[model samples]
Target chain A: MKNIDILVDNATCLRGDNLIFDNISFNLSNGEILFIMGPNGCGKTTLIRSLCGIQHLENGCIKINNVNINNPECNFLENLVYIGHNDSLSENLTTYENLEYLNKFDLSNKDEFISNPNKFLKFFDISKYKNYLVSELSQGNKKKVALSRLLFTNKKIWVLDEPLSFLDEDSKNNLIKLFLDHITNGGLIVTSTHIDFSNYFEKSKYLNMKGININE
Target chain B: MNISKIANLKYFYKHTKNVSKILSFITFSLFIVGIFWGLYIAPKDYLQGDSYRIIYVHVPAAWLSLQVYIVMAVTGFIALVWKIKIMEIISIQSASIGAYFTLIALVTGMIWGKPTWGTYWVWDARLTSELILLFLYIGIIVIYSSFTDKRQGAKIAALLAIVGLINIPIIHYSVEWWNTLHQGPTVTKFEKPSAHITMLMPLLYMLLVFNLYFVTVLIKRVRLGIFQREKNTKWMENYLND
Candidate 1:
């Protein structure tokens, strides 16, 4: 297993004039999962964004595999797979085209991605809707299509915000199975969700954003 | 000053010290002086008479139209190369101001042309190139707004700005390269300016005023960009409170 260490230390954040969270810290490694839990306005999404490098922290540092997140040379993004609250899929493009765009344009390891996306679509059980435009897909199917990206990407760290939000119980269980499969293969995951699934994983850690001090 | 520090969005947001006010003051003062000098003090053209006074506004507008694009292209290059968010903001914000300058130049040129070239519009090379530049600015703005994700839009627009830089030299040399109704260079030549000292002085002063105006507007717009992009950060919150 390739060594993957993720550390967030003394992290502080605010949204506009409101304190989101302060002095929060955590660490995780290969084959491990970190579940960030909090109430609706407790900065769970903000922390997830910071972990993905989409949002800046007010203080302290985040390091992945010993490389600081702020460092230009840090290759953390190359090893990351993120699915935010928004699917990040183009609405005008069909499901196939969206995945094709990711393969052709977005991913760093373009050649490594399977040239045919049918396998990923099949894995997500959305193969029948491959040609349907993202705008045409229902919310649950849209979430499934977004989840399909994880199958094709060989990223080590998966950061998902509310991965189970719109899914049925069956799809949720399927996703948890997929997460377990990923972890067993020495992958790291940091996900934020309202539901707690710590009992399903062996090396899972939990951080409740609501428990953190909110600096005024 | 460290280049990285300047590019740092938070550093720029806090340390910029609101210099747009000072720049606006300088721009206002210089504009007043330049307009007075050009309209009243400068000697009338032997050929065109008082009508040539339009050069004061027309020349500066034209020059700044081109100059603003250069600034956009340079900043775009920096943003793309270094992935600096502030530079991206500057590159995107510069498009509207640059477009306005291009429009002003084109409109004023047509007004001046009615008396000088006997028509309000023509297929002249310089004029066509300047019109194309305006289209390029519009293209950047439209492409940027089309994307729902602002960062992605900024990146794509930055690329377009860099590519459109080829039009700059074409516009600069169009008069010399092709037969056109428009007059050739006056203030930009390598040798001493062709126009008399009195005529050249106010034109140069007006050029400075236009440049100062660009900086003032650009600074304000960039600050606004910072606020919008960084609205969720603590420093931004504190800055807003202050």
Candidate 2:
């Protein structure tokens, strides 16, 4: 067994003059699920943003496989996938093109995924919107297009922020199934959600950002 | 430290409150002096007479049209590479402001051309390249707004701004490299400005006014934009109260 998959130590973030959250620490391993459940505006989004390396931490560090993710010598980028609270889709590009943009940036196992984008369009049941500009698609369809990036690669860590907010019931079930498949394939997921996805991942544990930790 | 970039947007707004007020005062006062000097006080062209007064406005507008694009491209490079949110806002505001000034330069040039060059329009390299520069600004704005997610919209606009930088040099050197009705570089000559002291002072004054005006507009527009984007957030509320 690996010693650790993700190690976050004393992660601190402050908003304005107030501390939104501080001294957050956690650990997770492959095939394990870490669900960050907090109330709205409780810094769930900020924490997720910090882990994805999108938001700078006021203090502390995050390491993947014992190498600091922020370190110049670390090669953790190829292994991390961050889906922010926003869909972050370029509406000018078609759904397929949006998927292709992220897929082209993969540093490893690049060639195998080129032919599979259309297959992924079908997997997310968003095939009809493949040629349509992402702006023209419905909100749920946009989320699906965003989620399709997960299908195109085998990234090790999935950092998702409020992923289930706009998803339909069937899409939610499809997402749960995909999560199970990803974990079974030795991938780790750290997600913040208002929705309870515990029924889907039985072993999933919760981390509260109110300076309290409740183990599963 | 790759993701260690910070966006002190509120900080900018806080500090620029007094600066923007001062700049607006200075730029407004200068605009009055510059227009009055160029139109009523400065000497007219020896050849074109009264028509050449447009140079005070046309030349500075055209110059800034290119300068602001450079700002956008530089900001785009930073935003894309470093993923800084403040740089993204600067790039977006720059495109709108650049496009506005590009339109001003084009219209003033055509008005100036009617008397000097015998026609109001020409398809010469410099004019066409400047037209394409307008198109590039439009493209960035259109593509940026097309995205539902404004942050991703910023990324797309940043890419377009960076790609559009190729046209800047073409617009700058078009008169020198190709035959064009537009006059050659006058105030910005590599060796020295060729204009007489009588004609040069007002153009230089307007250039300063144009640059200061750019800062004034950028500070106000970006502050308003950040407020809208960060609506209902604690930082924004605090900023508004402050």
Writing each residue's lDDT as its tens digit, candidate 1 over B1-242 gives 23353348888777665577778888898889988999999998877789889989998999999889989989999988876778899999999999999999999989988887778886566677788889899999999999876777888899999888976676557644663334344313223336899899899889888888999899888988888877876777887898
Docking tier of model 1: it is incorrect
Residue A207 in model 1: lDDT: 88
On a 0 to 1 DockQ scale, where is model 2? 0.09
User: Against the hidden reference, what TM-scores do the models get?
Assistant: 0.67, 0.64
The residue ranges of model 2 lying beyond 4 angstroms of the native Cα positions read: A8-25, A30-62, A70-72, A77-204, A207-214, B1-7, B170-194, B239-242
Q: Per-candidate RMSD vs. true structure?
A: 6.8, 8.5
Q: What is the TM-score of chain B alone in each candidate?
A: 0.87, 0.87
TM-scores, chain A, per candidate: 0.92, 0.91
Error of 2 at B67 (Å): 0.7
lDDT of 2 at B231: 67
* Candidate 1 error regions (>4 Å): A10-24, A39-61, A69-186, A212-216, B1-29, B79-93, B141-159, B170-194, B216-242
